[model samples]
Target: DVKVTQSSRYLVKRTGEKVFLECVQDMDHENMFWYRQDPGLGLRLIYFSYDVKMKEKGDIPEGYSVSREKKERFSLILESASTNQTSMYLCASSLRDGGYTFGSGTRLTVV
Candidate 1:
């Protein structure tokens, strides 16, 4: 079975702090992505990587970044956490675009 594990289900951080969210997939996949869900903004892509050591910025990568040093693992970094950055972060991995298996997601709250 394919699975994606998120290290944490929830997090609370102070403004201006650095935050890290992690995701790992059991299956070997070529693509991995990070997305943040907000009330009005909906689901906005933060970053994605297609291969080890290669990443691409997604739709809303302003205050976030990502790392993919090894296959099956992806990390999302909030450089300077802000209250507005609070959202539900989703991580997904797939062999290709047609099949995206997502983790449970990490809900972040900044204050």
Candidate 2:
């Protein structure tokens, strides 16, 4: 069975600190994404990778970066986390047929 797992379910960080969010997939999905979920703004794409060592900037990539050194793992990095960056981060893997499997999500709070 395919499974997506996130390293953290909840986190708290201070302003201006660097943050790392990790995600892993049991299935070797070619497409993966980092999405931020806000109450009113909905889901915003932060970064995505279609293949290992290949990453593309998403809609809101200003303060974030992504790494996919291995096909089964994707990492999201915050250059300098700010209060505005605090939110729920979701990691997702997509199958060729467009089916998506998402992790439980990591909720980050910046103070």
Candidate 3:
């Protein structure tokens, strides 16, 4: 089975702190994505990397960034965690013409 594992199931951060959310996929897929899901907004893409060291910003990329140094691992970075950044973060991996496989998601709260 294709599986994505997130480093945390929940997280809490204070304003202005740097936060890192890690994700790993076992399928060795070529594409990985980060998205933040909020009520009424659905899943808004933050960033996506089609290959190692290559990334593209998505709809809501402000205050967020991503790194995919290795084929199996992808990381999401919040340069300065803020109250507005608190939401459910999901990691997904996929290949061409394939459906995305998502992690369990991390529910983040910034106080």
Candidate 4:
């Protein structure tokens, strides 16, 4: 199976603290993505990388950034966590098809 592993299943952060969410895939997929899933808002893309050292801003990149230093790893950095940022973060990877292999997800809450 194309497996994507996330560093945390749940997280809590203060309003102004920095946060990091890690994701790793064993399939060596060329594409990796980070998204935040909110109720009624659906999935909002944060960042994506198609190749090493190559990154692209997705639909919603504000207050967030990503790193893709290797083929199997991707990281999401929250410059400053806020209450509005509280949501379910998901990591995904894909090769050619549009279908993405998703991580179990990380639910983050900012107080």
Candidate maximizing TM-score: 3
> lDDT per residue, candidate 1, 1-111, as tens digits?
779999999999999999999999999998999999888878888899999999999999999988998998999999999998988999999887558999999999999
lDDT, candidate 3, 1-111, per-residue tens: 769999999999999999999999999799999999999999999999999999999999999988889999999999999999989999999998779999999999999
For model 2, give the 10-residue run with minimal summed lDDT: 93-102
Q: Model 1: runs farther than 4 Å from truth? A: none
For model 3, the run of ten residues with the poorest summed lDDT: 91-100
In model 3, what lDDT does residue 28 have?
A: 79
CA lDDT, every prediction? 0.93, 0.95, 0.96, 0.95
Model 3 gets an lDDT of 0.96
Candidate 1, residue 104: lDDT = 98
TM-scores of the models, in the given order? 0.95, 0.96, 0.98, 0.96
Residue lDDT tens for model 2, 1-111: 679999999999999999999999999899999999999998999999999999999998998988899999999999899999989999999977888999999999999
Show the colliding residue pairs in model 4.
none
- Two-way TM-score contest, 1 vs 4, winner: 4
- Where does the lowest 10-residue lDDT sum fall in candidate 4? 92-101
- As for model 1, its CA RMSD to the true structure in angstroms is 1.0
**Candidate 2 Cα lDDT to native:** 0.95
